[model samples]
Target: MRDLSPPAPRARGALGVAAAVLMAAATLAAPAHAAAAPAGGTAEAAVTAPAPPMGFTNRDSTRCRAEFDEAYVKKIADILVAKGLKDAGYTYVNLDDCWARPARDDQGRLVPDPVRFPNGIKALADHVHAKGLKFGLLAGAGARTCDPAGFPGSLGHEAGDARQFADWGVDHLTYADCGGGGDAEQRYAAMSDALRATGRPVVLTVADQGANRSWEWDGDVAQVRRTTGAGTDGWGSVLARVKQNLPLAAHTGPGRWNDPDALHVGGYGMTETQYRTQFSLWSVMAAPLVIGSDLRKLDAVSAEILTNREVIAVDQDPRGKPGEVVASDAGRWVISKELADGSRAVALFNETNRPRHIATTAGAVGLPAASGYKARDLWTALEKGTSGTIAATVPAHGTVLLKVSADREWSQLPPLLDTTISGDAVARPGTTQRVASAVTNHGGAATGTVTLTLTGGDGWTAQPVTAASTDRLKAGATLGTEWDVTVPAGATGRHELTLTTKYRSRDGLTFTSAIPVPVLVGVTRPPAGESYLGDQAPLAATNGWGPVEKDLSNGESNAGDGSPITINGTVFAKGLGVNSPSSVEYYTAGRCTRVTAQVGLDDEAGTQGTVTFEIWADHQQVASIPKMTNADAARSLTADVSTAETVRLVVTDGGDGAAYDHADWADLKITCA
Candidate 1:
């Protein structure tokens, strides 16, 4: 990736001294590489030094194939160059497992599969090199590679394998851990030393499944370290990797990186929203943008997501520092990464199943005090003015990635004022909902008298609780206004309320803007009779793998791919199945009385899963099963919800990893009046 190439000049200009102020803030946050050692010490600083530069690769395409031949490998190389991917920064054609023979040659050297590579590995490498891209191969540290075919690995023959790969002109080597390897550090280091001794510049990528806290030691051992396995393209897998690797940002720097695995965008395992979230998060994490899908089948949407230069810039910033979480409330998160240009990449992520408003201030994200700020949405490329507040109503499992700069051209734009709302937007007919709007002046100059007016849809009424106008407000001042909005007794759907604000700039120019606030009316009632939980659509479902299944076991990470719900060889006709770290919630309308289900680890998980089930009514836990395993029989469970407005079904990993933790809620039933 020519990621090290100087980035194109950024747009400049914001009202007031916002640009200058933010530049000062960036000066403080973006420190030089020679800065004093952090809490970790000099060794840590040394490892943070820029490592060799690397481009993207087609690693996953080969992995998805059963057995790729020379024709296939060359085809991928052609696609990488011809599909605009190479121009977009992808520059490697990599081969995964099963590319080598199970046994070595008479000379004790690794050999390419005879039938698959009739022309040999050297020819393939040359073909790829001729396309102006590098070539990469995978090897195992143990006696055999991870593939079931048990290809010969580079365990005791590290030097010999290194020589063979070097002779083949291999540019990148992925050393994975499998086949009953000895100590991982010793094995990994042995290969590292061997590769160096071969007088070749091979980029070593350590794939140890994040064992032994690799971030703590792999910086010197390999150019890149796997922070986690390449999990399925499920939301659960993506979420898990992000949570595990997010705190290890301190270990990442130029040359060496903490990789959370391949890019799963444009895959079938998740929705478009979730895919965008993955791309945004990976870019901010500075993780390698390894394309994990077949290049031949690449879709337009995926290409767009992968080719967004703005997001990619955050990953390839000259500073090479990973983004870190600035603030978090429950499931809402605000992450900030400092760029080399004195700008900050802010990600307001909503990890919950419901839409949520996430907010943060420039000061909180390390921006200096400015009259106002300019925020550009990296995804939409839309530029907007903000009065210090950076916020958005993010969809479930979505992210709002913004490139925020201070005081770019403050004088050209009008005085900066931001408006926001606080309070519930849901109500029943004939009910009154109280909501407050706060307007803050973040301009460099004071504003003229500001007036705020509330108007509602037909049959709806809105009245201010007090005066809605304030005398000239100074810079950095806030005005709070409240209103009582009543829903018409006949209303049954969404009603819109417009909050309009009118004010004048210091130059006597007037400006007006209207913000729409939607109010949802009517209550969501539970089923009128006893019903199977699978029959009702959940208000929210956050699953560890794929989407929650109805009347089926959580088979794999794709929707509608699960088999019938089963536990201990017992089949149930009606229920829901999910993976660990899962939650399914339904509105009960405070009329539900009882909930019953037979729950256990599904037989589809073999004997490898262990999970615990919990039932929550409203916000309180009403029942729980401490532990259950795939080997155990299905157990009966129940929860009382006589006065509960909502019921949640949850499954958690049993104090261990969530791998294979497929759980079931067989024979689930709920009674409501």
Candidate 2:
């Protein structure tokens, strides 16, 4: 899987080939429109080509260090075919890392480790193909694989590896986790064009691991993309992957699936029930049916769970629509998927340690309550009968997967609850403030009376506020309200305004949802000629949003003024490297005329590194220090920020890099003209 790392040195020719692939994509990219559907199940979706492989994969998920030889690969392929997996859409068995030598041959050709694959890749492909299953291999975006001893990956060798795999009859090729280097989008596109040149269809799987937010860029390239990191064995790991992929349902469709790594079932760290939870969630998401546990050591319960046709059918549904996590509270959650025949596959999960009694009406889950629907348990394969209200007692970490079909058409299901708090994005301290909130009716029917409360810490108050109260709200309706809030005097930091509301769903189950309102509370303006920013009063940054940080290293490196700390303060902003941008913002009741400070790098020798400081008046960049380095010496800095309502101080990395780009803003001050 990919990670968040800077572009590392890549193969020599990758950039050149990347340019060519971009030109091809610009000309070939086209959107697939929604197509007509047949009644019942089995309708095809409007999907892009080289997509919708509808198969299985076995990576090293079960055993991170498990290395299989050619015989074991064939054995798994034979097992897949024998267990009727091939017929049910489990058709691809991929070879991960460890199969090839670390370096290429004299001719620069990737050579599989002779000891591991004596018959070579071609013979293995034949064996997989003979079993009516497809064969696949792995490559990385970097020059080397993630494995220290793994073969060189497919960076510059894209043109060669793509052709070689096609020649060997490989139908699937996974660009596994990168070597934490190079432009990910460009490298993947290079391989995309190379595979196309062979005139053979090969499905591309991008296991980019969400590093560069690859989902947005890889959509037009890889058919299936990994939305999370490499999978590990543990219930926490299983749930961790699930938590990452559920919200990305909107990004998935007919041919594209948001892979949450794989179905690492029947392995250590998970119980029988937890295994079913993993299976149910993957199926609901229309994910690949790739099971990574050793097939040779399958037990009765594991086989029964894996071979469940109903669950597999959800993943293989021809409609190509994936189920999504519609609503969740505490440990109780709901996930619903649209089916091919206008039906819906819904799952209710109890993720906590105690049993939970969950309930939902048919109309609440997008089914017409008027039309009685028949239900069945996917796990037990038992006919669970029909009713307008489907309720169950789900054990901890267990789920209820229901296939609901109605004889008559149903009214659309409403969003369970939609609440938003606005108008408080920015607030001034020491004053009564007002914010607006809008709550909508996303249930099947009308709701009862609702109570809302606004709460905050640090002596904040929201006691006396008036707005419209709701006695009842019809389906799909909205109610608007307001709140007058106030933070304590001199509150000069980012604070959260929480709105806690109690509402009951259409099925009469009450839920408490707390919504956070992010607001920056500013302090009073500094007197003219007074120091408001420096080592002592470091520019307070917005935690999750701003990259600027506070540190005390000026004296340690003799950064500027030969002071250990800020001129008279204790901290300064640092970590200002390339792409490591940091900023501090504060509101002023009175306009500030100018800002001044002393800045320098923290290089031990004072010979390397760079820093660029910019000042933003409101949202506009009014002044900047273009490029300063260690050799440039610590110097006085000034910027005209006159009549500025909001002022921001930003420190940036120098041109070369941020290796030792330590900077200090000593005696930083903002003053009036």
Local accuracy of candidate 1 as per-residue lDDT tens digits, 334-381 = 999888788899998988765567889998988888867888889977
TM-score (C-alpha) between model 1 and the true structure: 0.75
Off by over 4 Å in 2: 1-58, 61-67, 384-387, 408-673
lDDT digits (tens) for residues 20-39 of candidate 2 = 24432432222222221111
Worst 10 residues of 2 by lDDT: 34-43
Clashing pairs in 2: 1-177, 2-208, 368-410, 415-442, 535-570, 535-571, 536-569, 536-570, 548-582, 555-564
Q: Please, what is the TM-score per model?
A: 0.75, 0.55
Overall lDDT per candidate, in order of appearance: 0.76, 0.63
Candidate 2 local lDDT, residue 63: 25
* Winner by lDDT: 1
